[model samples]
Target: MKEQPNLRDATYQEEAAIDSNSTSIAGLVRQLTREVPSLFTKELALAKAEITEALNTTKAATIGMASGGIVLLGGFIMLLLSAVLGLSNVVAPWLAALIVGGVVCVVGMIMVSAGKKKLDPAAFKPERTINSMQKDKEAVKGKVA
Candidate 1:
């Protein structure tokens, strides 16, 4: 009769592979445990650096953009003067200028407020890195377990 294979006993390659896996997992777990904190610190530092750079850029751009806005506002005010003059045939000139200038300024401020909202620093939180760290934490837990 032919000899039957032993189901309970692992062969040489199987044992080797299992040992290799366990050793690698242990090594990876140790490396992760040691490096994750430092990695997070570095990432945070990078984010702060990038945000600071961005803030500086924003400041410079704001100056240029504000100048452009002023120039545009001057042009618009000139055009609105024509409209105000036309309206002055019916209403008083000062009333026309006040009504048109006030409405234009309010609309411009609203647009600026919308732009300001987009540039808010709080919106640039390190969400991606935080999520990656959380995922890595879960993966390390799975490996250790």
Candidate 2:
């Protein structure tokens, strides 16, 4: 009885048949032209998806920062008023306001710094899309050569 070819050998034979069918340079060029546009469209879709995801992430961060700013402003106003009242009898009221304002200013600065970090351009880079594009570029080059 004849033995069946192993999967690997069968795959190789199939690939060989395909390669032989397209052995001509014109065939290769036709294949490239047909495939490259499809590949480009897929890459563009991936890039668009990644950018949309990044933009969504940025939107969330922006909302957080905006919320933090509003809260910080309200907190600063309330705290300053309370601190001024509480310290008015202990120290000059102006000095108390100045001290409270400085502390609140520091807290706002911290919030701003955190927000700035989140908005970093590097963090928004479409890493997977970039890597995929590089691989596709190499693949195209190999096919051309």
Candidate 3:
């Protein structure tokens, strides 16, 4: 009863029996050179796009935070000015409270306006480039699954 040859094992053994002298590292590298550029280009583009998106997000967040801080500081300054005006009788007996109060009010209004401009939601809305990048990312993720 002769044993049947294992075709898978025989094929592997036949491949291993090839002349080792026929292959070289440079030939392997040459083969890879033909395949790698397209893959690398795809990966590089994805990375660049991801980085650009992250930077834009950071810029938006920073603007939002700075705006919030400015608004809060302006409110605090307004409160302090009110307190000073109320205590005018003791702090500066001769100073005209109305003049100082009016000036402070003007400054507060300016701060409020500046803060509002900074925090304007429309200003930070994603541009067309960012929107397209987001769509591309979503498409890639969809394909991955």
lDDT of each: 0.78, 0.84, 0.66
Put down candidate 2 lDDT per residue, 1-145, tens digits, no spaces: 9998799998898678668858787768877887899988998999899999988977887799789889887986786798889988798988888887788789879978986776678976889989999999998898778
What does candidate 1 score on TM? 0.59
Clashes of 3: 0
Global lDDT for candidate 2?
Answer: 0.84
Taking all chains together, each candidate's TM-score versus the true structure is: 0.59, 0.73, 0.39
Over the stretch 1-145, how does candidate 1's per-residue lDDT look in tens digits?
Answer: 9988786565776566555665686666665666789877976876677677777877898899899999998998789989899988889999988888888889889998999788876755656667766886787688677
Error of 1 at 36 (Å): 3.5
Task: Find the 10 residues in a row with the least total lDDT in model 2.
Answer: 14-23
lDDT of 1 at 113: 95
**Model 1 spans > 4 angstroms off:** 1-33, 49-57
lDDT of 3 by residue, 35-99 (tens): 45765576567667766786788688889988998998899778767766776856673364655
Model 3 RMSD vs true structure: 12.3
State the displacement of the C-alpha of residue 100, model 3, in Å, after optimal TM-score superposition.
13
TM-score ranking, best first: 2, 1, 3
